[model samples]
Target chain A: MGTQLDPEYVRTLRSDFAVAHKLLSDRCLYESAKWSAEALNGLPEDEVDDPEILIPDELKQLDQMSSSERRQYMLAKACFDCREYDRAARILEHCTSSKCCFLKWYARYISGEKKREEDSEVILGPLDGDATINKQVILIIDEIEEHFRTVAAAVYDPFLLYLYGVALIKHKCDKLAFEPLTRAVNIYPFNWAAWQELGRCVQNVDQLPFVLSQIPPTHVMSKMFEVSTSQELFQSTESVFATLAQLENIFPSFLYLKIQRAMLCYHALEYDDSAKLFDHVVREDPHRLDDMDMYSNVLYVTE
Target chain B: MGTQLDPEYVRTLRSDFAVAHKLLSDRCLYESAKWSAEALNGLPEDEVDDPEILIPDELKQLDQMSSSERRQYMLAKACFDCREYDRAARILEHCTSSKCCFLKWYARYISGEKKREEDSEVILGPLDGDATINKQVILIIDEIEEHFRTVAAAVYDPFLLYLYGVALIKHKCDKLAFEPLTRAVNIYPFNWAAWQELGRCVQNVDQLPFVLSQIPPTHVMSKMFEVSTSQELFQSTESVFATLAQLENIFPSFLYLKIQRAMLCYHALEYDDSAKLFDHVVREDPHRLDDMDMYSNVLYVTE
Candidate 1:
């Protein structure tokens, strides 16, 4: 009783499905996910507004992997995409020999979070290592460093070097920390975490000039090193003012810089300027108890 | 040598771990996960840009769920959060009598993507109505409808209603689809998927007046329905022209509206206007072969 409206309509419908299937089968997960979502919503031709799908389900057919490996790979990548590096590392650790070199390295690297924390504490925690703590941390650090030298030698990932540098720094080998940290930043100038560690690894006043040259003064973390290390090196206020002046130009609104300048003002006997800067810093960051202690010390002397 | 940096500071360190353990033991997965990550990274007070933890490793602690139920709950919730709704449903399907009612309803409702697709095809696919196709699709639809009516009767979740409306639409019970969809849009107007499907369900020529009153003409979706339903209602070009004029003001760059306008022009025997509009559409969406046949018909008339 009913006639077809267009002679080629059925062929056109089949043609549409051909295009849709091709889009879904594409190996690139992000691209395939986009088209598959559009087709699934019955809007085959239009780009759907896609803020809903946050993590791209990366469970596409991977080459030459067992079922467990594939699941771990997908889960690890999903975790990494979600910024759960530690969980990703955990999944990869459980995977029965990950074929992916990056996966193998990343799993070991990030799962070292607990070890890294303990190692840092032994080096920087209270300075009373008690012999046993240092021995335990050093043994673990040695194993990690040896693994990096052997297993990660073939691949040149900046993250691995970042970990290596962090381990060395926590081992109190600041001179050895310098090499990997330098290579890391040279490879990837924007690794904020690596740069933060690099800020703390400079050995003394002489090495500060070299590290400063390597790291441009414009970086906030670079400025952070000067403030943090001044106390570490017990540098005289007069000796550090030249460097602090350059940091001041770059970080005018920096709270730590204001406090650093206040400390310098206190040391230089500029009581009024020191009082004003300390008052400003406290108002800005009241919970910075270290700054409050410094403020009290300044007030006591100035009054 | 540094004399342990005060006995209290060492105890404070141990106390911090105690607090962390207490938090993790509290069965609040999100908060516990946060502290664990913070402790792991030595970033005690900072929000780390975490890129490796997924699913909060929620299987570790569930209040009273049996092991299988706990696993399924974690997998299902993770999948849902990741927008893998179909997968979530499958996991939830295997879950042994989940105590959480919300989880049960959602798993069953949304897991029906494949069934819904097949159901929609039986209703709207090729008007053949093969006996097996109708029986299977109707069976699934009946089950979904009955479940919604009884089990989800008291709940006012917009997503649950959205599922109900979607099932009705796929079954070609557009009149029944209207109630759930109307409530769906009422509860959440920005449900674009529901709003788009709602444009297709108005019954007949006579019902347009009532639906227009129910949904204001100023609403973009209501305007969209006018264009979509013009052919179905056998609306005269004159009747819809006023509505199209209003729609043009709202959606000036809408391709479907342009094609609808072109079709109306062709029916009205305004060959010149039809040709111009179809030509514009083809240029904008150069590969729209569906419009090509219409373009050919318009060209033949115009020439």
Candidate 2:
């Protein structure tokens, strides 16, 4: 264990796992999150049994394609998967399938973001740090919003609605993002990414109930969103704790759930209890360096 | 993208994903690592098609159990999954199956680590910092070493050998760890965790060739290990870079692979090439904050 955890490489790995875990949790890929947590503790990767993803019928209709078209589609997909976004967009320029359209526009959006990361020369206002994106990125967002808006108007695909919603959110049109995101969750509530986007559009705690009414309130995903949003806004800790406890039962030893509970305890001014919970977390996952900044505060207060 | 990436919550998330990425890379779960990279870039979760894990026959014999025994086994499993390690260990005290024995001992070992994390009063040597573990943990290592030494002599389970090797390593018995870890990689070469432990036992570049000879020469895992260990010792970078480039072709846009190449370029004093690669990685994964310390160093030198 000393050989495992005391090394400089392990320290670097601990920090990296922290970031990955947060992303996995945000995506509501909790099973993957569990794998990360185990990995953080120097536990070996247990071969997991993930449910198979059914390929959409449209995607499965490759047999109907001309060989050249099939080759183009396959090549585009390969390019897209490798993050060669521009090449993927170029190859799919004339493909008329819904998947192709989504892919092309999505690639364009990502390509634009990549450009933004490279565009460090953009002058920032005195107050702005890395948050001020380049005009090129803004142009791409506008293009994404325009394309997704048109595509979503014609089709009821949940993913299309989600992209439309995300584009709107990116363009800083949260009011416009609202309906598409709601439609997205209504169509496919299990996609936590859509729910998270919807959660972002929500302005305040008072607006949450109305937003909650618009989607499937009984869904565990909605409950998760509610808990997340409420925690973000620092409201209704008691109910959030209860809901999280329920989620804990569902996702046993979920690191994110435990961290949230620990945060909730801190928020409630249960300093000793929060400290203990944080201690428990540290004990189980000693290498987890993220989220424990709050634990540090808890320790400070208790000490 | 601004709304997604600019918020304080998102800043926290970026740092978190950094840690999680490192852990996932260390575990060699690159498919899940890809998911994390996407998540960091604010990409929606794409439904993945993960291959199913085959259940070993020993674990599949649950149907042959008496109803009461089955109930007991499931209860213990539930307790174990929730991280009630002590409860799980107690529940499996009388169980005799190989799986049960592994679980029982593994739970006990984890429980010991947890206790050590909570043991805050242990005096550290002047040179020791957070690396100084409590006596309780050391005691558990001693117990684990003794248990595994006896158990491994009678069984050829790769996982058992892994645990035994880990115990010996913890007990400052790397000589003992070497054979078990070698046996582990020989028996189950795909387990990156065992390979990592084996890698730790290697003292210098001179020892690497002999170690490499013990494992499957043509296996991709072995190749990955060779690249990893070579990079760690900072020897044979030209060959290591070639291996990593081959791996990059195999796993397109693998962040860790890209980062490794960047580091290798930096090591070779190819600052311009390394800077360009780092810039590309940053653009593709704008939210990745870990491994960019080297990027910062590159920038400092270039400036």
Chain A (alone) TM-scores for all candidate structures: 0.50, 0.68
Q: lDDT tens string, model 1, A58-121?
A: 2121133553354345434434434465555555554433133345444444445444455554
Q: Evaluate residue B31 in candidate 2 and report its C-alpha lDDT on the 0 to 100 scale.
A: 35
lDDT of 2 by residue, A57-140 (tens): 532332233323333444454345445677667766776654565566666777776776675554674424356453444554
Candidate 2 CA-lDDT value? 0.60
The second chain of candidate 1 has a TM-score of: 0.52
Fnat for each predicted structure, in order: 0.00, 0.00
TM-score of each: 0.34, 0.45
Evaluate model 2: give its TM-score. 0.45
lDDT, candidate 1, B12-99, per-residue tens: 4323333333322222122223332222222122222222222223222223354334434543443444455554555455443313
DockQ, prediction 1 = 0.01
Q: Score the docking of each candidate (DockQ).
A: 0.01, 0.03
On the 0 to 100 scale, the lDDT of residue B147 in model 1 is 53
What TM-score does candidate 1 reach?
Answer: 0.34
Q: Give candidate 1 regions above 4 Å deviation.
A: A1-303, B1-88, B94-155, B169-174, B190-200, B288-303
- Say which candidate scores most in DockQ: 2
RMSD of 2: 15.0
Per-residue lDDT over B136-249 for candidate 2, one digit per residue giving the tens place of the 0 to 100 score: 345545655555566545455565577677767766789888998998777656456677789899999999999999998877568778877887777646678778765554
